[model samples]
Target chain A: MQNKMIGYVMILAMLLFGGLSTVQAADGAKATNPEAAKVEKMIADADKARKKAASVEGEWRDVGKMLKKAKAALAKGDYKTAKKLAAKAKSQGEMGYKQAVAQKDLKMPSYLKY
Target chain B: MKHLLKKIAMLAVAGGIAASAQASPEADREAFQNFYKNRFASVPMEEYPNGVYSIDPVGRENWEAIEEFPPYEPFIDEGQAMWEKPFANGKTYKDCFADGPAIAGIYPLWDKKNGMVITLPLALNKCREANGEKPLKYKKGSINDILSYIAYESRGQKTNVIIPKDDPRALAAYEKGKKFYYTRRGQLNFSCANCHLQNAGMNIRADRLGPALGHTTHFPVYRSKWGTVGTLHRRVTGCNKQVRAKPFKAQGEQYRNLEYFLTYMSNGLELNGPGARK
Candidate 1:
């Protein structure tokens, strides 16, 4: 009887600890989704880039809309879609800012006589 | 010897300043008109008020046919009725604009008191608010109605947008507008000059890009694509969007300044608003 009781105690401990470990692992995943975090960072960068472009009145129409869509994808845990969109938006923002900066001095077109 | 040196230095400085200073509005206008004159040697200066139709012979035939039974006629009639109708405050638009509806040529002017460009649509809205009436939407709706009537009546009045010499701000506004025109924006990275100025009379897909000259003479245009009469700002908004850039608000400082510059370009062109277009 003593041996049987010891065996049952060991099995019970294993089941309890195993179940607890599984729950902990799930909690860990929920708390620290590296992919989600990366996507959020990308979105933040895109927003900063967009604002920089807008500061010079160089913002493209779809950059804002793209950022919004990226955030929505991020909320839905669609990291791939979010990252792709955020990257495009950031690129567009940079392009627009560069475009405006390049024309800082009004270089009237060659065709247009001053 | 020192006095002579100082006078020479002062003369050099003055010459530099004169050279660096942007061409006056009049000079700019002359250059702008001359560009089109040289490009379309066959098309007369007076024919420009007809827009792209002046250059496109085939399109001009269709445009002439459309004009015979003018689509904008009802809008003009509606605008006339609105003009005649009294406001809620027992005042009509005439009360505010004593000069009356034929006053479209006078607009897109510098409002010295406001330190801003005041467009016709904005003036009309102010008139409405002053008379205790609801302001109309800028891009579309009944605003086009009243504007159609005003433009129709104002036909033949020359587009003479004066940037007052007294107010330096007026010239600054024109400069801002000129900058805006040349600046590239949007995903397409196209400036207003890319299509309208650089590629004027060139076909983009099926549509021939119209010349920037006389662009502002016809406003409140009835475009077949729109199927309704829309203001110049409305067309401007569409152009921005076409290039995939965000559009500025109608009558907003940016657009008003743009209108000021654009109208100034069309100076001496006959007012031919409430125009039909494809």
Candidate 2:
């Protein structure tokens, strides 16, 4: 009877672990290609932001290069690197735009003051 | 109550000063001229076209020596030849200018029709295009040579840029140019005035800075560093890069407007281009 109890406990433990492994497999699949659609949206948004900034003559250096590289990485299915570069490019472009706007009403230096 | 009144009085004074500081082209010219004169009491106004050499005795001596056998002489000769040379249409540069003496000083004009500043180089290119010849590059080589000759011929003509009040666009362009002159940009965050105006006659390492008062008087300067003649725009580009800013295209609208603003500031100064400089 004790041996029979031991067999039942083993069966229960196996069932619990087997269910957990299945969930783990699903999580592993999610991790390998996690949020690819979200990363693509981020890249698209960054590209638009950069273009808007450039139209007003507020382009900063390396933003274009970064974007291009990001797109290239995305094409190669390297979503992690692509998303990082795109985000950086977007930030740089936004800063450039802000700078151009601020310069429009720039204060003249005291020496330049009449 | 007394302190508050005092603050109000100070604010009024500040407002008055600010109102005066919105400089008109005419007012700016007068003020800039006075500022330079006051700063360099020893140097004669006419000698300002000599740039840094005017303020530095050692630099002047060296410049004078270079002038004795001016390295730019060959460029002038070459430019004169090109000027006289006929295009495929058998038309010459004289056809473009109507045989006018080199009018370098009267340029960067507000073209009311085109709604743009017509610089000497741009006009030259337009002339070339009309005659079915390819336009020359704006920065260096044969273009620089041609400008050097024109500037040499127009030497002593006073810089007299006009921003006609008839057109609102003209004023806007002038204001834009003025803003650009003062706006700090690039990684270094230096404006054109930082080196040329505020730090004028001061040295940054081995280089002595020139004043902005007569900045536009000379162009197509034969810089030893370049080992060739360079135009005012080229010098401006170099200055922009030195301040870590991305340079605009030579003869682009931004530069043309800047030229217009600077030339206006140098009203009454003589043109002495194709100059030699270190």
Candidate 3:
């Protein structure tokens, strides 16, 4: 009776593992580890978030106005506020103004190094 | 008195003409300033640019004998030998791709189906591995060596990197690259685009800014300053160092994605190996 139970347990374990193998093996020949798939998914999620954020089109004009102000502050050597505003503005602009500009799909400013 | 007045009249008219001539350039510049917010077809800033990658036909200043950093002859030659050497699979690196000189422009591309970002260096080593050969080492490895060797091969391909939007992988990589540039890294917390692209033709202290265009061509350049044939990532590391940030390793995906982004920024620039820069 004990031997039969052991045999039954062995079969169950194989079935469980085989079910998992079938799911994982779906990617075909490539190893396609779960971790790698997870990473790929995370990347995809990030991309989706970025695209959705891009489409919403927030108030970048506020940033353009703020950037104009920041530039003015910087030119006046208000280094403290200029730096703070630049930082604050960058976060705001990085997402907003940047998205519009990127969406404009403007040529990278020619002066920039690729 | 009459002759002097006549001379004055002529001088006045000449002055007006000269003023207009001088103002013409500035006037045109001002006129076009925002006409096209993105005036030219912008290249991606992650890897290399697009459209017929070739070296700048600009005159080159060869540094064949600079001692502080010998032209990367040593590294370049080493790379050449590695390229010709057979892999365990009996295939030369040359056999894995089309002629090396014309292949520099295929990288920093997106493949929608694969959802993967492929950079030039990764592709080179990938070909080797596909032929039942070992992947070349990234830094101080066969892969790194092949870059210079392959750079020699890429001598004349037109810079043409096409980022296919349809490819989820390509688009994803492009976005990754774009973020990498804008995201401030390093202790200084500056983005690569901050100094290089936006401020092209400006200066970092005494160094003159280069227009980011045509940058893709100069990789594996023999920097007389460094005496090494550098991969694009090494340059990225150098940029990090300048900003006081701890640099990433040569083979990290971050750099690869950055390369993709940078190269994409160069959408229509040429790819010249080992171009001279200050």
Candidate 4:
């Protein structure tokens, strides 16, 4: 009855708006300390890593490509492959992040370094 | 098909009642998806009844509860002992300030001579360092010296943070913080102002949004997630991770400046230090 109608409405709503966050990611982190020296170093390191990740020749086109594949798998309800690639990309990203934060004498969060 | 529809309706009603009674992360996520799609940035800025880490109704709260909290009573006792210990000229902790508790509001003020802002916590550390004792971190033992003494001193004093409106230096520091809040810098590409300033009541994953205003009133509260009491800097570090940004050092200039801005936002709120947080 009414309950069935509400369930249908709710699922449809999630499909319509599940992807968007409350705030747009495009204009995110405006309150971050840009002049933070440690953050600067880490950003530089991550940039280098991003470039390096993008330039791989044989198996990996880039983390971007992998992420796209991961995203596609996700859209297709393939959680297993999506989780694997996301984990892989995370490790590569973490490696570069480690070098950057370490070089600048900053304490790394466990997730980034370990 | 009609019978099936009736069955589905009955099941759905039962499920909704159950889900409402016992909400799970999955249920909350679905709620956020239904109610707040992408409004993850702005947070509510009103005074929350229970002072904990600022909550963004729109996002998932990372820290849940701290099983064990470090007892500040022992630390405060040590601070008291340190305060009672004599200084160079046989000066007692009482000699340090005419009225110790009356001093908390005057700190983190604009220092025109230094062209910077100084916090009372920093000032106390500076006094200790100048007199040859190691300065303590904001929530560490040395802070206990101030907090314990100031806790005694904190009686009847105002909890307002006063920054001169005309001072450009203060404004500069504030603007820096403002920029940090609005700019997207992390892997998740989220900002503090996004959750705290803009979307206070919007649901993120499971938790309700909270306002950033008056956020400073409940610092150094016992957190269940860390299993101990800590300061706002530690909480900020946790947030950096949520957004996938590299966290600046706790109590570093950035956090201090941000504290300055946050205190300014909570200017008129009374001091309720050592609060409790989830």
Candidate 5:
């Protein structure tokens, strides 16, 4: 009876430890996936760029919408689509900021005689 | 050392004079009107209120025909009804505007107390809210109806926007508006000046870009594109989007300041609003 009781205790410990490891492994796979991590970083970089442009009142209309689509793509595991959208958004943000900065001084056009 | 210091002071003073000369509102307006005058020498200053029709003879024929049987007639009638109708509180728009309907020319004025630009549409909405009625939307719908009537009533009234000397903020608002006009924006990289000034007569595909000179004179325009009348701010919003830029809110600071600058530019031109447009 004592030996049987010890055997049952050993089985119970194995089942508990095995279930915990399975859950941890699943979580580890999601956390360590390089593609997902890369896309997340790209999205974050795009958002930062967009905010920088907005700080100068130079943000384009579609940058926010593009970032939103990128996040949705990332959620659906579409890393390639997500990356492309994020990169385009970042480029637009940079262009808008540069455009605004270039015209910091209100230069009257040559055609208008001032 | 004294000689070098003197040279530096002279250069600084010269630079300061140049900047202020360029910044003067009167100087800017003169330059703006001259550009249009030089471009279209035949069109009288009074005719600028007709917009592109003053320049585009071919289009003007069609426009004249349309004006004979104006599409905006119904809106004017509707607006009159709206004007006469009392609010739930037994108060009317007259209660707010003692000067009455023919007061379009005096608006887009700088409100010193608010430290901001107050436009006609904004004032009308304020009147509504004060009378316990819901404020009308700025860009579209019933607002256009009332504006059409007010604009028609205010016809022939000259555009005269006053920037008070007492308030430095008013001048700042005008300067900001001027900056907005000249500054390039959107994916297309076009400023308001690029289309309406630099290439005013140039064709962008099928459309001939209109001159900026009398832009503010005609408002609450009957756009065939919209199949109804719309406000100047509505047209401005459409222009921003056409350039692929995010449009600022209608009647917001950006647009109100823009109107203040634009109307100031059109000073002395007659108001022919509720005008028909393609």
Candidate 6:
């Protein structure tokens, strides 16, 4: 009976240690994914785009908001989510700038040509 | 060979004239004025300052009724008091600007020292700040009231904004304002000219889009929708918001420049501001 109880205690200890080690490994992967660097670069690129939009006074409110969210997600170690948000922000910023540049020569009806 | 050369010369001359016509504000103004005059043959030039009311008979009846006991009257009274009241240093608005009626028409002027446009409302705020008082807000309440009085005082004064060729900055500001007027913005993708120029006198839903001609003549308008008088910048902000565009600050450089351009377009039209509108 003594031997059996000792065996059971050792198994319990192993299970507890194994579970903790697995969680740590998962956390490590979450915090230090190989893709994190690529996402960081993408976020930087998106931020540059946002700045370009703002330089021409063409930034929309959503572009800024999305960039903020992207940075927040990045801070939380959610690289995938951060990359997605950053990409969206970048698209919006580029589009806003394009719209402003295109509008530099506005089109009006022939009657309103003056 | 001689005939071909002559044709080329004639073509070049025609192109030059066309380019100059587009480039000259005076030429553009003449064309703009003629467009309105020809379109609304029955309406007199003086009445253009009245805006949509000058064109829409039923709207005019309603507008006249509002004018009989104008809501802006109290604001003008308030403004008169503000203008006459002494500041912290015992200096009044008179010390800042020429004391007389119709002074508002001369505003949105280029300030050589500042290298920027100085609008009447901005000038009023500056006077306050100069006199050791806090400046009034640009779009509402006491500021609008004082502007109302000033506009009322300036009634019948023709807009006469000048862009002195001597100052490159002055022309730059005017050009910026003109670009803004024609530039499409907002999610709706419309320029100021889209509604005011092309669709003037036309109905968009229930409201008539007023002409760009004499648009600046009557400002600080008692818009029935707002149930209070609003400055031209306020109207601009409202228009921008309506189109889903974020507006520049009232009295800011963008707006000041826009006012300069718009007021220049209304040159020779009588100032009829603090007017009633629907």
Q: Fraction of true contacts kept, per model? A: 0.82, 0.23, 0.02, 0.00, 0.64, 0.21
lDDT of 1 by residue, B144-232 (tens): 99999999999999988989989999999998998798788888889998988789999999989999988888889999999999999
* TM-scores of the candidates in the order shown: 0.86, 0.80, 0.52, 0.52, 0.87, 0.79
Share of the reference A-B contacts seen in candidate 2: 0.23
Tens digits of lDDT, candidate 4, A3-97: 36544644565577665521222112212323222332333444456555323210122445555565555443345675676656555565544
**lDDT tens per residue, model 2, A1-114:** 753654465456447786454334323333454565567678788888777766665656567788888866664456789889999988877776777777765565566436
Error of 4 at A54 (Å): 21
Model 4's alpha-carbon lDDT is: 0.51
Comparing 2 with 5 on lDDT, the higher-scoring candidate is: 5
lDDT at B21, model 5:
41
For model 1, residues A1-114, the per-residue Cα lDDT tens digits are: 753654465456547786454334323333567776777789889999989988888888899999989876765556789899999999998988888788777766667675
Model 6 scores a C-alpha lDDT of 0.79
Highest DockQ: which candidate?
Answer: 1
Q: What is the interface RMSD of each candidate, in Å?
A: 2.9, 3.0, 14.3, 15.7, 2.5, 3.8
Docking class of 3: incorrect
Candidate 2 structure quality by residue, lDDT tens digits, B51-163: 89888888889899999999999999999999999999999999999744488977979999999888999999999999999999888779988888999999989988888
Q: Tell me the DockQ of each model, to 2 decimals.
A: 0.41, 0.18, 0.03, 0.02, 0.37, 0.18
Per-residue lDDT tens digits for candidate 3, residues B76-159, read 677778777787888776686655635666876664655566666777778777888767656444455567666656666665
lDDT of 5 by residue, B160-274 (tens): 9999999999999999899899889989999999999999988889878899999998899999999999999999999888887778889989999999999899999999989
Candidate 4 chain B has its poorest 10 consecutive residues by lDDT at B58-67
Can you tell me which runs of candidate 2 are displaced by over 4 Å?
A1-92, B1-14, B17-21, B99-101
User: How do the candidates score on chain B by TM-score?
Assistant: 0.92, 0.94, 0.67, 0.66, 0.94, 0.91
Q: What C-alpha RMSD separates each model from the true structure?
A: 9.3, 11.4, 18.0, 22.6, 8.5, 8.7
* Residue pairs with backbone overlap in model 5: none
Candidate 4 lDDT over residue span B31-124, tens digit each: 3232322342333433332333344321223332331343444544565677677777666556666666446656557677776767766677
Give residue B89's error in model 4 in angstroms: 6.3
Report lDDT (Cα) of residue B166, candidate 2.
89
- Evaluate all candidate structures by whole-model CA lDDT and list the values in order: 0.86, 0.80, 0.52, 0.51, 0.87, 0.79
Residue B117's C-alpha lDDT in candidate 6? Answer: 98
Instruction: Kindly list the per-residue Cα lDDT of model 6 for residues B81-148, writing each as its tens digit.
Output: 98899898988888888664358877889999999999988888888898899988888778988888
- lDDT, model 6, position B83: 85
